[model samples]
Target: MIILGIDPGIADTGFGVISAEKSTFKAITYGTIKTSKADDLAKRLDYLYKDIEKLIKKHKPSKIGIESIFFAKNAKTAITIAHARGICLLAAQQAKAQIHEYTPLQIKQALTGYGAADKNQIQQMVKTILNLKEIPKPDDAADALACAICCAQTKQYV
Candidate 1:
């Protein structure tokens, strides 16, 4: 199955696409969607919506795995991310893709067997899981790949 994973952010939304069979994952593509702070919030969200929609149309993923929102230190920042996340959920729904949301801790634990695993540890696991030469780039894309790996392990396609 082609699984599309997303780590949503207002400024830089990370996305990764991978093919999964049972527990094995092979990376297809990974990148970030950057939005300008100079643009209005609505325009930024619209850009995200359009870009994500394009990705779905391009990849035709069977399902989507998204990182769920957790408590953030900055309330305003959290709210901003929630907006981006909302657009992602909306896009998946509109595409008729099965959606699964995972918490950061759940993703870490699934990949590393430890919920408290740090970013480097989780990225290392992602690298190993996908059999990549290095951790996926730009941190956020690696995080999205990790979320996909978690769902690939925990969720059964059949």
Candidate 2:
């Protein structure tokens, strides 16, 4: 099965694509989608949507694992992230892929066996689990890979 994982953000959305069969997993691709703050919100979202749609069309992943928004002290920031996340969801839906949502805590625990694991810990685990020579560049991309691994480990898919 091919799975795509997304870590959504207004400025940078991270994406990781992996192929899984039984207990084996392989990283197909991973990267970040960047948008400048200089652009208007509508334009940024449109760009994000189009890029994500292109990814779906190219990879044709059967399932998508997306991190759910965690509300911070800043409500405005959370709302912006929600908008980016919604674009990701819309792209997945348009592609007719099964969507799976995982909270930050769930992803961390699944990846590092600790809900409060730090970013470094999660990144290390992602590299080790994927058997990569180096940790995926950009923290967001590693987080996205963690999401994919988490979804694959879930009983629903197993």
- Evaluated at residue 41, the lDDT of candidate 2 is 99
Which segments of model 2 are wrong by more than 4 Å? Answer: none
**lDDT by residue (tens digit), candidate 1, 55-148:** 9999999889999998898999899999999999999999999899999999999999999999999999989988999888999999999887
Residue 23 in model 2: lDDT: 88
Tell me the RMSD of model 1 versus the true structure: 1.5
Instruction: State residue 25's C-alpha deviation in candidate 1, in Å.
Output: 1.0
Encode model 2's per-residue lDDT on 44-111: one tens digit a residue.
99999999999899999988999998666799999999999999999999899999999999999898
Flag regions of model 1 displaced more than 4 Å: 156-158
Residue 17, model 1: Cα distance from true site in angstroms: 0.4
